[model samples]
Target: MQLEEPQLKPRDYVVVASMLFGLFFGAGNLIFPLHLGQIAGANWLPATLGFLVTAVVLPLLSVLAISATHAEGVYDIGRPLGKWFALTFMVLIHATIGPLFGTPRTATVAFTTGIAPMLPKQWSSAGLLVFSALFFLAAFLLSYKERKITSAIGKVLNPTFLLLLAVVFFVGFLHPFGAPSSAPVTAHYQQAGLLNGFLQGYNTMDALAGLAFGVTVVTAVRGLGLKRDRTVSAVTAKAGVLATAAIGLVYVLLILLGAMSTNYFTASAEGGTAFNQIITYYFGAAGHALLATMLTVTCLTTAVGLVAAFAQDFHKHFPKVSYTAWLAMMSFASFLTANFGLETIIQWSTPMLMFLYPLAMVLIGLSTTSAWFHRAPVVYGFVVAFTVVPALMDMVAAFPAVISKSAVGLAVTHLRDYLPFATVGLGWLVPALIGLALGLTVYAVQQRQHAGAQEME
Candidate 1:
C-alpha cells in the first residue's frame, strides 16, 4: 500500500554527516577545548578525556536517541512527558540556543576573536555593531529556506571551514609552539581534572544543540529519500558517528595546540582570546586573517542552523506566524543581543543553562533507554519531577546572592552537603538516577496490575 523511498548512497551519508559537524562546531566548539587545554596543562590527557565525554559523547548520544524515537523535532522527543511539558521544554531549548544566548554568542565571538583584534581599541564597539548586523543578515538569508540548509552548510560552508581549520592544525602541529609548558594547574584542574573538564564541556552547550539540531538531520535524511523509521535511525546513527569523529579530531588538535602555546601566550580571560593569541604566535599577521576567516565561517554556519531550527519549531506550533517572520524576528533579536558581547551573554546564560542542562540530559537518557520502559508517560513524569528538584537547586546555587541571605538559601545550602557531586555542580546526578529507578519500579507494578485486571475480565 505504501512506496518505500530510495535509500541514500554512502556519499550522501558523508555529506549529511559533514553538515551535522558544521552545525555543532561553532564558536563555543572552537574556544572551549583550547581553553581546557591551556588550563588543564599537565593534566590535559585526563581532562581531554572528560571533555570528550560531555562534549562529544553526550551530544552524539542525544542524536542517536532522537533518531531512535523517530522524533519530528525536539518537542516530539519530549512528548512522552506531556504536551505542555514538551512545549515548554522545546521552547526553552530553542530560545536558549537561538536569540537569547547561542545565536548572539556566535556573532559576538566571531567579532571578538576574528575582527576586533585587527581594529583599534576605540573602534571595537562600533565595529561589533556593524559586523553583527551584517553577520545576522547573512545568517538570516542562508536560513530562509530550511530545506537547503544541508546543501548550503554541507556542500559549501563546511568545506571552506574545514580547509581553514586544516591550515591552523597543520601549522600548529608542524611547528611546535615552544613545547607544552609544565604550568601549574588551575584550581579546578589541580585535583579533579577530569571532573573539571567534564564541567567545562558543558560550556559548549552542544548537547542542547544536538537536541535542537536533530530535526535538521532528520529532515536531511528524509530528503535523501529514506522514509522508514528504522532505516532513518540507522542512517542518523552512522551520520552522528561520523560527525562526532570529525568534531573529536578537531577538539583534540585544538586542545593540544592550546597546551603547547600556554608558555608563549599570556593567560586570557576568554578562550577566544587565547585561541587568537595562539594563531598569531604561530603565523604572525597572516594567522590573524586565517583565524578571522575560520571563525566567521564556522559561526555563520552555526547561526544558520540555530535560526533555521528555531523558526521551523516555532512555525510548526504557531502556523499563523510565517517562518520568514520568525526568522526575521530571531535574527533581529540575536543582532541586538550580540552588541552585549560574549562575556555578558555568558554571564546571563549561566543560571539558565544550570537549570536546563540537567533536565535535557535526563530527557536524553530516558529517550535513549525508552525501549526498556515501553514509553510510559508516568516514568517520564516522575523522572522529570525528581530531576527538577536538583535542577532548581543548581539554578539557585548559580546565583547564590539571589537567595543567599534568605531562609530558603540557608536550607538549600545545608541540603547540598547531603547531595553527591553537589560541590562539583552536578548535584542532579544522584537524584536523576533515583528518579529513574523509582519510576521503573512504579511502571513495572502498574503493568503487572493491568495484566492481572485484564485476565480477570
Candidate 2:
C-alpha cells in the first residue's frame, strides 16, 4: 500500500482534461487561428506550426512547470524571488485574468463579436447590459462550488461546446469552400508568413492564460485524491497533455476553415467577422443557431474557470474573506465591466498583456529549470530584472495612439526602437539570455565560496 501512489481513474483524467481545455480555449482562441489562416493563406501549414508553438505548446508547458515545481500556483511560481515580488506578480496575474478585465472581456467578446450583429442596431447598449448580466450570472453559478468545477465544465459544458462546433466543422469541410493551397496571400504574409504567424500566436496571450490557469488545474488535481505533490503533478501533466492536444486539433480545424473560406469570402478585418461570415454562409438565416451557442459556450467556460481560480487563490491568501464572497465579488465586477467598460477594459488590458507576457514567459522558463539553479532567488531576480524594461517598453508601444503620442510614451518608444527584435515583439530575448549567464556566473562564485568556507572549518 505504501508503494502505491494514489491515482486518478482514467475517467478522472478525461474529466480533468476537459476542464483544462474548457479553461484555456476561450473566444480569443477561436478567433486568432481563423484569422491566421486567412492572412497566411497559401502559407497556412507553416503558419499553423507557429501558432501551435505559443497557443498549444506554451500553455501545456505552463501546466508542466507548475507541476514540476510542485508549486501550489502562480504565487509559488515566483516565491523563490521573495515575498514582495511573488505577491506583486501574483496580484498582477490574477488581476489580469480576473474580473477587472480578462474575465469580463470574455463576456463582452462573445456578445459583441457574435451576438451583437444579429440584434437590432438600437438595442446594442441595452443588449450588452442584458447579455452581460446573464453571462456573468451563468458563469457565477457554474463556478459556485470549487469542488464541482471539474465536472460542471468537463462533463456538461465542454462536450456541449465541442458538439456544437463539430456541426460546423463537419458540414464545412465535407462540402468544401475551396482549398487554401492557392488562396491569395496578404502582402506581409507573402514577405514573412512564418515570422508573422509566430507573432500572431504571441499576440493571443495564451502564455498569460497559462500562468493564470495553473492554480485552477493544480487545485483540481488535489481535489481528485492525489495527496503527494509528485502524484498530483503527474496527473496534472497528463491532463494538460490531453487538453493541449485537444486545443491543437481544434486550432487546425478552425484555421483550415478560415483558409478554405478564401473561395467564398475575403478575409474580414478580424476572426470574429470571418467566423460570423462563415457561419452565415454555412447555416444562412439560422446562423446564430451555431454561432451564438458556440461562442457563448467557449467564453462561458473560460469565465467559470477564471472566476473559480480567482476565488480559490484569493481566499487562500486573504482568509478573512470567504470563498463564496470572492466569487460573488468577481462576478459582479465582471458584470459591471462587461456592460459599461468593455472598450476601456480592452484598451488597458492590451498594454498590461504586452507588459506581462514576456515576464510570464521568463518565469515559466525559469521554473521549468528551477532544479538546475536550485530555485535560486538571484537567478530569478536577474532574469526578471533584465526582462522588465523591455516588457515595459512593449506595454508603452501597445498603448492607444492618443497615449503613445505623448512625450513620455514617445521617448520610451524611441528607446525601444533601438532594442533588437522590438518590432518582432521579442526585444527581451537577448537581455534575458544575458541575465541568465550573469546569474549563473554569480551563482557559481557563491557556491565556490561556500565550499571553501566549509573545507576550512
Candidate 3:
C-alpha cells in the first residue's frame, strides 16, 4: 500500500504565501508602479489594471505553470526546448536575476532610497560603495543556507517590510498631498495606457524570477512534509494566489499614493527619487528614516532570495562547485555591479529585458498548456523560433539612441514597421500564435503517419 503525504495547514499556507511575496516583490516593484501612476495621471485606474495583468497575474501563473509541469527548476521548464536551449535559457534567467542585474539592483535601490538622501553630496559615491559591500555581505550570510530562506524571509523580513509600508500607506493616504492631476497624460500613456502599462510591468521581471523561484517554493513545500506531487502543486498554487493578492494590494496602494502626489511634485527621472520625495514630503525628516529602513529591509530580503535560488540551481548543475562557493561568488559580483549605480544598470538591462521577456512569457505559456499538445517538442521549438524574430526587433528598438540610429537599427526599424503590434512592444504575440497553429498541424500529421505505418506493419 502507498502512504499518503501530509498537507500544509492554513497557517503554513500563509507562511509560504508570504515567502513567495517577499521573493517577487523587490526594487522594481517599489519604483515602477509609483512612476506609472505619476505618468498615467487621471488614467491611473486603467493603467493599474494593465500593470496588474503582467506584474501580478502572469507571475502567479508562472508559479502555477511550474507546479503543473512538476519542474525542478527553470531548466526543467525549458527541457521540451531541448537540452541546449534549456541550459542556455536557465543560465540567462539565473544570471539576470542573480548577480548580473537583479541582485545588484536591490543594493542600488537601497542606497538611493535609504542611504543617499541622508548623505552629504560629496559622500554619496563612497557611501554607495560601502553600503553595497555590507549589503551583499549580509545577503551572502543570509543565503548561505538555502533551507532556511523560506522561514527567514516569510516569518521575519516580510512582516517587518509590510509593517513599514503600512505606516507609509496609512499616513500618505490619510493626509493626501493633492488629488491626481488633471494635467495631460504623457504622450505614450495618453492613448495606449493599457499597453504601455503592460510593457512597464515587464520591468519588474517577476515572471522570469517566477521560473527560477519555483524550485525554492517546491523545496520549501516538501520541507514542510508534503511529499506527493499533486499535494505539493496544489499547495504551491494556493500559496501563489495568496501571494499575488498581497502584492496586488500593495501595488494599488502605491499607485494611489503616486497619483495623489502628482500635483505637488514634478516627476523625477528616476522612480526611486520620486518615491523618496513622496515620503519626505508627507513625513518630513522622519520619513527619510522610515523609507530608508523599509527600502533596505525589502531589498535585503529579495537579494537573499535571488542569491539563494541561483546558488541552489547552479549547485545542482555543477555539484563539484558547492552551493556556498556559488553564493559567495554571486554576492561578490553583485556588490561590484551595484557600485555602477541604478541608472546605468537600468539602461544596460533594458535591451536585454526587451529580448528575454517575450521568450520567458512564451515558455511559461507553453509550459502551462503543454498537456493540450501532448508535450510535443516541435511545438516548443516552433513557437520559440517564431517568437525570437519579434523579440530581437524589440531589442533593437530599445537599444541606445546611437545604436538605433545605425545601419542595422535602420534595417530593424523598417522590418518592425511591417510587424503587427510592433509599436507596442508585442510584435511577438502574432508570430507566437501562428507558430502554435503550424506546430500543432505538423504534429497531428506526423502522429497520423506514425499510426498508419504501425498498423500496416
Each candidate: what lDDT? 0.87, 0.86, 0.87
Candidate 3 local accuracy as lDDT?
0.87
lDDT of 2 at 84: 83
RMSD (Cα, Å) of candidate 2? 1.6
Q: Listing every candidate in turn, what is its Cα RMSD in Å to the true structure after a full C-alpha superposition?
A: 1.7, 1.6, 1.5
Candidate 3 residue lDDT tens string, 1-457 = 6657765579999999999999999978998999988888778888998999999988987998888898878898889978888889999998887788999999999898788989998998999999999999998898777778888889999999999888888888888877765633677778888888898889898999999898789888888888878888889999999999999999998887777777788766667877999888878999889888989989988898888888888888889999999889999999999999888888878888889899999889888898888789999988999999889988888888888779999889789868898888888899999998889899999999999999999
Give the lowest summed-lDDT range of ten residues in model 2: 1-10
1-457: candidate 1 lDDT, tens digit per residue: 6767786778998999989999999989999998888888777888999999889998998898888888867898789878898999999999898899999999999999999999999999999999999999999999888789999999999999999889888888898765655754677787898888888888888999999987778887887888788888899999999999889989988888888777677556768988888888878999889889999999999999999888888888888999999999999999999999887899878777888999988898888889998889988888889889888787776764656447887687668657898888898898888888899999999999999999999
Give the Cα error of residue 90 in candidate 1, in Å: 0.6
Error of 1 at 336 (Å): 1.2
Rank candidates by TM-score, best first: 3, 2, 1
RMSD of 3: 1.5
Higher lDDT: candidate 2 or 3?
A: 3
TM-score of each: 0.96, 0.96, 0.97
Residue 421's lDDT within candidate 3 is 89
TM-score of 1: 0.96
- The CA lDDT at 123 in model 3 is 97
